[model samples]
Target: MLYAGTRHRDYTLRVPLAGDLVDAQEAHPQGLVRLVALDLYRRQLLQLGEIPAEAITLELLRSELTEIDMAELERADAELGKRFAPPRPGSSTGAASSTPSSVTATPSPTSGA
Candidate 1:
């Protein structure tokens, strides 16, 4: 299912997997959606060989992701049975977040203590 993209699509819009988080952590280091986009498109970019990956900044990709029309993308997300999420870069409040906000960790007692 297509989760995010625009009319003239720049990257593959396939559903992002949970494993993507681990992969994205090493490289993209951006929000899930933007990381997903970069994870999908970075190597294949016609510009990648010309410029090092480090040279590409989050703002550059964010500019591309910010243009996606949320109305259609959000509808597609629902159709795919995905929870609502804003694909806008740096947003992780909803489904875009791999970890639920409701989760709280209680401190575990240390064996040494």
Candidate 2:
């Protein structure tokens, strides 16, 4: 997944985990890995804003996450997913009408509480 940061930022992040993360997100709905990965990617980009394209590496991202941050990231990730995830198949909700909204377009402010 090529994630664009805030709309104002010109850089794009190539998330290597995008495929597996989406798979886990839909398949293992209760898992936190996808959420963690999402938070890590966002933080990595924000922390290193306007850097060279080649500077965005998996190691740099992994280095920023800790076990203590997992709980917060998990919560934020769940909230972000809930707000953005497409309605499940055969569900009855207005969100179903808005399916296919761009998830990788920009980062939203998910309450960290």
Which residue pairs in candidate 1 collide?
none
lDDT of 1: 0.38
What digit string (tens of lDDT, one per residue) describes model 1 on residues 20-95? 5466666756567655555543332332212344644455554543333323333333443343344668765554
Q: In model 2, what is the error at residue 66, expressed in angstroms?
A: 6.4
lDDT of 2 at 16: 29
Tell me how many clashing residue pairs each candidate has.
0, 0
lDDT, model 2, position 101: 47
Over 2-105, each residue of candidate 2 has an lDDT whose tens digit, in order, gives 22442122322222245655554565477576454654545434223344446555544345434444344455446555766677999877533644643332
Give the alpha-carbon lDDT of every model.
Answer: 0.38, 0.44
The local lDDT score (0 to 100) that residue 111 gets in candidate 1 is 11
For residue 5, what is the lDDT in candidate 2?
A: 43
Give per-residue lDDT, candidate 2, residue 19: 61
Estimate candidate 2's alpha-carbon lDDT, on a 0 to 1 scale.
0.44
